[model samples]
Target: MTGSTEASLRVEVLGSQHDRNSFECGVEPLDRYLRMQAGQDARKNIAAPFVLVMPDGAIAGYYTLSSTAVSVGEWPVETVRKLPRYPLIPATLLGRLAVDRRQQGRGYGRYLLADALLRSLRSEIAAFAVIVNAKDGNARRFYQRESFLPFPDQPMKLFRPMADIAELFR
Candidate 1:
């Protein structure tokens, strides 16, 4: 299926033979991590992965969403103080996001992210925030551009309030 826009791309949840092959070709590191998670029986903790395929049927990129828990202490004090003294809150984790080297600079990564956030918004799992551990400066910058705020203690990690993200869909 083609994307709705001119730079048409298809985004689908990962499954099946074709999806596996596309994931391997596009983002082997992410694929390896997913396999490891599956081997460790941690797949139950994660939402399904999704992949973006170009019109030519090549995987352009992929991302995975997962249910996660975060302690109130982990958040900024300003945000934490507003909530009741619960030990932890349910959160959504963007576990892996990668683009094929060949597909880099084509805006497929942005497309993959937009698709991921849209799906997350529709999920039944309760999530007060979306969190990501950015792998590098470039990755960090990408999330920053999308309005994700850096964790005060861990600059490499970033988060977006679910309310802010929801407004984007409006």
Candidate 2:
């Protein structure tokens, strides 16, 4: 499936035990970034994982969203001072995102991310930004192409303010 052909694609969240496993096996990136960190991050309330399933019940892709704390010092001074000192501002971290090899090139990854972002916007999560640590140069490029900005000090990391993402849906 590719391009316009995917207009009718059916994508939904993984909601069952089998679906979770399938989603795990379908994407290594998800496994590395989220599943492996499930114990330490997820259980500790640091992050949450979500999966995208196709109509046939096959796992197409997966992503993780989590609450993160960024120091006011990490942000530009202009943006930092505007925020309260030591504020635990809401943040959504895209811990991992991957499309199955079999489903690659179908734009499923974009769909998966869009779903995650939309959910964040709608939820009362209070996230000020969505952050992603790209696994490699390719992943970094992908996020950058999607309008995420790379941190000056950390090129592999990309971020998009929630307000900026919300504007896209308008």
Candidate 3:
């Protein structure tokens, strides 16, 4: 879909009104999370799940954001060198992101990820970066394409500093 067309789709907090049952991203865990645990996670203030709703009210995609912390050691050495001596750094976790299988290659994944990053950047919480734990190699590549750097020790785990992300929106 074109950027203008995608812009017309609403991105909002997941709620009872959003249909979660039919959302399938070709990933069982992702689909199951939306159908099953997303609501509970939202209610408990664990993670804030957001959904992309089509004009006809179908869910095109979803992502979750929550406060998280990472040990400084988990970062690349260059990243750690620039940080304070704090053992654990505050961050936002882009915990889960999925686009429905039908919407996969239409740029919905990038759209959802951009929305998630913007939300994280605008939050009042003191997060130094946005973190993601990619489920597989494809997922890892997806994040890397968006400039998320992989931790030296954990290739599938990645993050992009809030400052760098801010530059994109600016």
Candidate 4:
């Protein structure tokens, strides 16, 4: 498609028809997960992988969402004080996210992220936030730019409250 833009992209559940082999975001772990484990995870109900598809059916980017939990103690005191006294808080894990190397600079990462957050917010299951474990400093910075906050003790692990994310879409 000529004059293509991110708006022209569509996000859908990853399926056998989607070509995962050619998706490379210059990250080996992320690439391998998508190509090998993503389908298995989906089948096992461990995670739901969504792919950003071009008009020609090429996979430009993908992300996985799964149910998770975090200890209340892991949250900052200021944040935890307002929350329930439960030992663990429900969350949605953004397990893996990556864009094809060719699509890296085209804003597909953020686009996939937005779609993931919105999906989490819309889910009937209760989740206080969306959490991500950044693979490195650069990934951490990326999530931080999108308003994700690093846990006080775990800089690579970050979260953005569902309420705040809801406000973003509104």
Candidate 5:
């Protein structure tokens, strides 16, 4: 989609009226989870879900964020040396992110991730990083392009410090 066309997709907090039932993101687990459990997760305060709606109001994609923490032990020694000596460091989890298969290559995923990062930055909670547990190499690579770094000991667990995110947006 062209930038103008892509811009027509609007993102807002998931609501009962959004059509999530038929959304498919190619990944069965992700698509199924969003269709089946996203709302309940939101209602239970477990995570906050946001949906991307096409101009016509059809749901195109979604992502979730929640308060999370990481063990300092998961980081490189040099990285940990720069932090406080706490066992767990505050972080925000990009718990789930998906772009509908129908719209997969239209750049919706990147826009969704950028939205998630900006939302995390605006949050009142003090989070040192935005963390994402990438399910596979492709997902990890996508995040890396957005400047997220992989934990040396855990490549699939990626992070982009809030400072970096702030720089990106500014």
Candidate 6:
């Protein structure tokens, strides 16, 4: 994969057999959570984690996503009136995404992100958008560049509508 694309790498749903003790993404919380808590979260139906694995079975990167919602007030009044008057709008939460330090510059972050979006778009769940709670300014920028817009009053949180994502697959 050195001189080629990541076409050979595959994203696997995290499971008991996958090695989690050795995954190190250079971020304490991300690494710790993946090693110690992602499984529990998945078991509880809170969020599902996916890991990118090279053919040799090394963990390259991972991301977690779960069902969530946004308040109608999070959007502009014009948009609110057009949607259901429910207190919350359905969404998929891209909770966390991180690349192992060794795989940092190989575009695995983007790869994982594209995979997450594709999964969200393909799901039958009722989601109006895919949302992310960016950890910092840099994280926010990444999502913004990927076409996720900031909610009306939140700069650190962003979202891309499901309709927009659906258009990509067509």
Ranking by TM-score: 3, 4, 5, 6, 1, 2
User: Model 5, range 25-134, lDDT digits (tens) per residue?
Assistant: 88999988888898999999999999999988988899999999999899777778889999999999999999988888888899899999999999999999999999
TM-score, each model? 0.83, 0.79, 0.97, 0.96, 0.96, 0.93
Off by over 4 Å in 4: 1-4
Tens-place lDDT digits, model 2, residues 1-170: 55554665555533434244444434465655533554455557666666666657666777777777665556655556667666566678887788867777877888888988888788786877888899888899899889998766778877788889989899
* Backbone clashes in model 1, listed as residue pairs: none
User: How much is 155 displaced in model 5, in angstroms?
Assistant: 1.0
Predictions in order: lDDT = 0.75, 0.71, 0.94, 0.94, 0.92, 0.90
C-alpha lDDT of residue 68 in model 4: 99
- Which candidate's TM-score is highest? 3
lDDT of 5 at 18: 90
Q: List model 6 lDDT by residue over 85-161, tens digit each.
A: 89989999999999999888878888899999999999989899899999889899999999998888888888888
- Candidate 3 or 2, higher lDDT: 3
Runs of candidate 5 with Cα error greater than 4 angstroms are: none
Candidate 1's residue-wise lDDT over 40-96, tens digit each? 433464466777767776667778888888888888988887777889988889888
* Total residue pair clashes for candidate 4: 0
Clashes per candidate, residues 3 or more apart or on different chains:
0, 0, 0, 0, 0, 0
Task: Give the range where candidate 5 is weakest over 10 consecutive residues by summed lDDT.
Answer: 1-10
Candidates' RMSD to native: 3.2, 3.4, 0.9, 1.6, 1.1, 1.6
- Arranged by lDDT, best first: 3, 4, 5, 6, 1, 2
Name the candidate, 2 or 3, with the larger TM-score value.
Answer: 3
Cα error, residue 41 of model 4, in Å, equals 0.2
Model 3 spans with C-alpha error above 4 angstroms: none
Which of the two candidates, 5 or 6, achieves a greater lDDT against the reference? 5
